[model samples]
Target: MRMCDRAGCDQPGNCPAPKSPNSPERWYFCERHAAEYNSNWNYFEGLDKEEASAREQAERAEGASYRQSSWNAWAGPGDGSRSRDELRALEVLELDPDADFDAVRKAWRSKAKLVHPDVRPGDEAAAKEFQKLQVAYEVLRAAEERRTWKGPEGTF
Candidate 1:
């Protein structure tokens, strides 16, 4: 069974949270503890108002471009079940939201090959696209792994 990370909280830790901003590591907590942990989060803790605003604007702009692409693949098992980042990753790979891991793998490989730095040597644009594809694949792969994982026992 997956026990909560919080000491003494003998509950199923179904909610997964990042250990820190921009970190791949995670902390598993019960629903209540997860809510409590999130309530106190400060996404821009150290940044000044201007810096925070700038960061927010940059993020919005980046997000807007994705929306502008008119790619909404949420039709099937992934309808509202996937995260925003997952949808974005699907868009990056030109895939449908319900695409299985095998499909994702194929899409990523085919697309990645075209923009791979080695294949498109010295092409800055291709390199940038390649990096984006890499991150997208990583996100989808992690999500798929999470979906297929079955806790030790009594965790459900």
Candidate 2:
């Protein structure tokens, strides 16, 4: 016969373990205390309607951005290899309109490495393509720096 753990409750079998949200630890409460706790608990009492709505919107936007970023990372700049013909390889590899300078440089390096002719040896055409890749990387890199030092829509 285990006694209830709740203070002032000496009755046997009156205390049951209550679930805790923070961790695995459980607290035992008598029936009366449990009801009182439940009644007083308010999950959203501190937040006003506007604050709650803003939080919901921010969460949704963050999810959408994550999904878009993942799709862009996996699809690899639309070089016409797929059914959709929306973006050119250069356009896809170009600095994103919202990207900061560091991100732009990182993206340029990654894409340029893939198309570098030294990687595919023994082909003149591949070398020419590599030259084009180098030019594109340089252009984007310069543009990114200019944009960072200047403002949005700034040209190199």
Candidate with maximal lDDT: 1
Best by TM-score: 1
- TM-score, prediction 1: 0.49
lDDT of each: 0.85, 0.57
**Total clashes, candidate 1?**
1
Model 2 lDDT per residue over 62-149, tens place? 7986554433443333332221211232455664444444665677678667766778778787677667666655665554343245
- The lowest-lDDT stretch of 10 consecutive residues in candidate 2 is 80-89
lDDT over C-alpha atoms for residue 26 of model 2:
57
How big is the positional error of residue 7 in model 2, measured in Å on the Cα after superposition? 90
lDDT assessment of candidate 2: 0.57
lDDT string, candidate 1, 73-139, tens digits = 2234365667899999999999987788899999999998899998989999999999999999999
Which residues of candidate 1, in runs, are more than 4 Å off?
1-76, 153-156
